[model samples]
Target chain A: MTKPLLTVEGLVKRYGEHTVLNGLDLTVREGEVVVIVGPSGCGKSTLLRCINALEPIQSGAVRLEVAPISRESRDLPALRQKVGMVFQSYELFPHLTVLDNVTLAPRKAQKRPRAEAEREALALLERVGLADRARDYPRQLSGGQKQRVAIVRALVMHPQVLLFDEVTAALDPEMVREVLDVLLDLARQGRTMLIVTIEMNFARAVADRVIFLDGGTIVEEAPPEEFFDHPKTPRAQKFLNTFTFDAVKRPHPSSLADPTT
Target chain B: MSIAVLRDYLPLFARSALLTVRLGALGILLAVLVGVLCSAAQYFRLPVLQQLSAVYIELSRNTPLLVQLFFLYYGLPKLGIRTDPAVCGVAGLAFLGGSYMAEAFRSGLEAVDRVQLESALSLGLTNAQAMGSVILPQALSISMPALVANVIFLLKETSVFSAVSLMDLMFTAKDLIGLHYNTVESLTLLVVFYLLILLPISILGSLVERRLRYAGSGT
Candidate 1:
């Protein structure tokens, strides 16, 4: 558990003149779940992207296990294979059936046997409750089902670490639970994951450690219970208070209890 | 009187239509191949190839196919490059058709959401693999209607092949009108033969577009 499976040191990401992630540093040990909470445009998503090497950084380095991941890295494909990422849009390959989407990378990139890849993909799809949708295209699936298929697609890669960039942000209310439940199951299984999300209750329920980020930096990091009940920083308290205020002030008192949950 | 002349020229019209189909198919095949290559060069931003593709597309599109065939068959002989009339016909049609096909593919490639590429990269696909397996299929589907339109345009453009002396439908029509003075009958036969070759393709294009629309509905 103490072994750092993934590490980001002083990562600096900028688009043109605007800097998004400013000298950020973080580490994720093997079998740990870290949930990141932040306001929109605070660089939570940027940090995850930099770690996955999907976005190039101006400075600093990201490492999975021992090897550094960078644009110049000779083995970027192999390096990226070890880091699975799920996007908020559930970017399943729209042209492919769910099974084909899940099996594509394994068979094509890794050069695995098609039958073997399909078998593993079917098992993962079954786990995500999408086994029946194996023949269906992305357009045929609902939001929750599509996200689950996306998760299966990532899991089929057998990555050393996973990054979830607001995975449930775009899902409808009822669909949110199905996706979060999948994440909670993965957490219970001790999968190493770094998640960026605004769902405070899900963050509290699943995080081993909650990281509060603001203005391109970490403002606070603590255990879930401690951070949720008794945030140390004034900024953290104010952010949490907004969620509470929104919940209390809303006119609809119907099934809106703990709205984020 | 016209019906009797049309019956008399049926064999000549059939032969001419066959030649036209063969030439049009060859030209469209070459055009599609060139189009995919040029668009790929633009999409991937290949060094000299991208610029050359841009120049070729502009030059080919701006000039007429008849002018291109004339240059290939007539003008090139002065420069000691006498190409066969059939080759000139196919090449001229390809030159014109390639630019339109490339533009169609480029638009389709651009319309694909950026997330499609990003997600493929996140899943460990190499740039080539992502483009080939993920991006190209979606782009091709999106480009279907434009490609069908280009195919029809190229086939119709095959009418100019007769100027280079290839004995196509237009040449057969002109020869019959000159010899027998049956202009209406020859032109009617020409129209019917062209429809024979083009109507099936138009119908097939619509069917494919509907299927693709169904598959790509929510996307």
Candidate 2:
């Protein structure tokens, strides 16, 4: 097995008295793709935010390789560079062109030269099929296109781990496929990604391991096939049942027994 | 109105108008500099500096510019510390305008969505870097209208500079009326000169505002 690229041990996050993540622990090895799914307010997004050090943790530690992720750590900036995150809103810098947005971090934070960063950014933009829109502002693009640009933005950082927080949740129904396709492409390339998503089909297609979380704790985790087809825990079974249309569409036996039909 | 009196004072008005423009520009520039610094202090929540900035904003904003100028020019010499009239004029204007500009800029800074900072941080940018690059530009764009309004306001406030005996446009008009007793011509020239000074700025301010809106919205 490849070495762990990211590790979380006893991760605790709280907003005031209400604990959002209750001592959750997770690990991602090199080039592993982990898909986390849970009901609303289950702390999946908070977990990702804690991992990225966007939110301060209450107790547990998150480490990128060997260095700890925290506000006080001297190497935090360097460590954060290795963990790229894409938000659901597609938070592109509105004042910049697509090309400029892609190049900003490399140039400003990484201190890369303008010419070199632009060269790499242009290539990445081309890879994402956004070469034609390089000079366009973010507002001019469709939701899918903006999400794709966001993915490219994260990718250009050459991060070892990528966190996607419902990257498709805000998209139009038709636009969701385009963003999911991009994620599938990234997974195919063996990029290390921790994605929180609701698209079950895409999750089944792309996830190496599926994790079911509830009430701020992991209920079950297994390979996608086993987890989805045969969820061992009753909570996981109950959660999975919510996603299936059969629960609502099929009539209950009591109703079927009635002769009203 | 006598044409001869109007003709005689035209040159004086022109020179005084130039002085008003120069002083107004200086004061407005100082106001912007102070405003940016104070707003940054408030936004970053620096230890003592933040408290100092808060006090400064309240102190400046609550008092009138006339009172501020009086305190600076007439009140300060009692302590045996003398300030150049020009310096006093600029400082007084900045002291007044800075708080207004700071309020405008602080609102702009506050309006920036929290996600921008998060995205910038996740990309490994430091807090200062995130603020300078990601936050400030958007905030400035949002603050453009308020900032322009503040600028026009500061320029008009320069009318108070004559109270410090600077021979600004108002002083020139008052001096001419005192000497020649041609109140109508002097006051008319005062109105015309102020219009000339303020109209261009208001128009230019709106143009810049529109440009920023287009750039921000891409519409």
Candidate 3:
């Protein structure tokens, strides 16, 4: 088989004396949807940052198209252009209008004409149902709207791989669905994605593979259907139990016990 | 308030006020330059530049503006580097005002969401591009009020240039007052002279603060 579109090999990251990602590895095939679910401190966010070279790695490598992305690598900038990332906080450039924010990467780094970049940005905005808000600043958008715009911002780069780091964790309950629909649409279009998220239902529906990470390493990896139905490890089982079954869907996971019982 | 008495003094007041405006403008320009350069050095953490910027900020901030002026005007001459009084005065205000501006900018830059940088990097922007496009604009707006107030402080501080015999506001007024022995006229006119210069700048500063107001999270 051809190499995965992106690969993490024995990645290690540390903050001072505490290691956050320890000898962890992952591979994302082209057009594949991978979801990473973990407790808060399990190094999910650090993994994404290290992939984009946003955080320094203590050891190992993050490779894109078989080229290593490291601090000293001359191709880091060019590699960055190929792997787009959407931040957890919906970190849109607040001063720019939604159109400018979406077009900034293409216009500046890609050296595309501003007018051309903006025209493409407007179409992406339209796809995300934010076409009318092209002129509005990030401050004016709701959390969901901002996240969609951030997704559009990343997509406009036409990257080979997309990384989502808890993309919907900060949104209101009502707002979360809209952002998930956008991600789902991205997946349907065959975009390669590595998502760190807590929205279990969205992950259940959208992920090709679900990864359970604990204690700085992936404890279990399986297709979402298999992982959700038959969690392999105690950590995975305990985490799934913590979900309140609050989402309105096929009768709550354990709520509809057999009438015979 | 005789028209003819005012007419006779108008040209002198105007010349001195013009001198004051030039010094204020030049001093502010230099302060902005120093603030951007030094604060960026601190932001990037360049070794020798950061250390020099720290020393410059500390030494200029701790010393009084008047003392800095004397040191530039008198002390420097001892080492055979003589500068004109006007040069000394403008340079002194910039030197002093720059330290405060740097502090204002450092805090402003810090207040910008760190996540913005992370997002920018992930999008393929170089560090400099990210800072110029995302960070500095927000920082300037956030730091505007402090920057303006410090500039106003420098404008007022220019009055101290009279001690260095720069022929600025106070020096010009002192000369005319002593020449005329008309304390009431000279002092009253002096007050108006300072106001005429300061009021417009203060108003402009407020307008800028209002214009660049971050409409994002009020935090």
| Between candidates 1 and 3, the DockQ winner | 3
lDDT tens readout by residue for model 3, A196-240: 999999999999999998888899999999999999899998899
Q: Which lDDT tens digits does candidate 1 get at residues B1-219?
A: 567787889999999999999989999899988998899899879999999999999999999899999989999889998799999998888888899999999999998887889889888899889998888888888899998998998999999888999999999999999998898999999999999999999999998877775367343
Give the residue spans of candidate 1 off by over 4 A.
Answer: A246-261, B2-4, B210-214
Supply candidate 3's per-residue lDDT for A69: 91
Worst 10 residues of 1 chain B by lDDT: B210-219
Q: Model 1 lDDT vs. the true structure?
A: 0.90
Could you give me the TM-score of model 3 versus the true structure?
A: 0.93
Cα RMSD (Å) between model 1 and the true structure? 4.5
Q: Write the per-residue lDDT of candidate 2 for residues B128-185, one digit (tens) a residue.
A: 8888888888888899999989988888898888888998999999888898788999
Tell me which residue pairs clash in candidate 3.
none
DockQ of every candidate:
0.59, 0.63, 0.60
In candidate 1 the C-alpha lDDT for residue A169 amounts to 89
**Clashing residue pairs, candidate 2?**
none
Model 2: lDDT of residue B180: 76
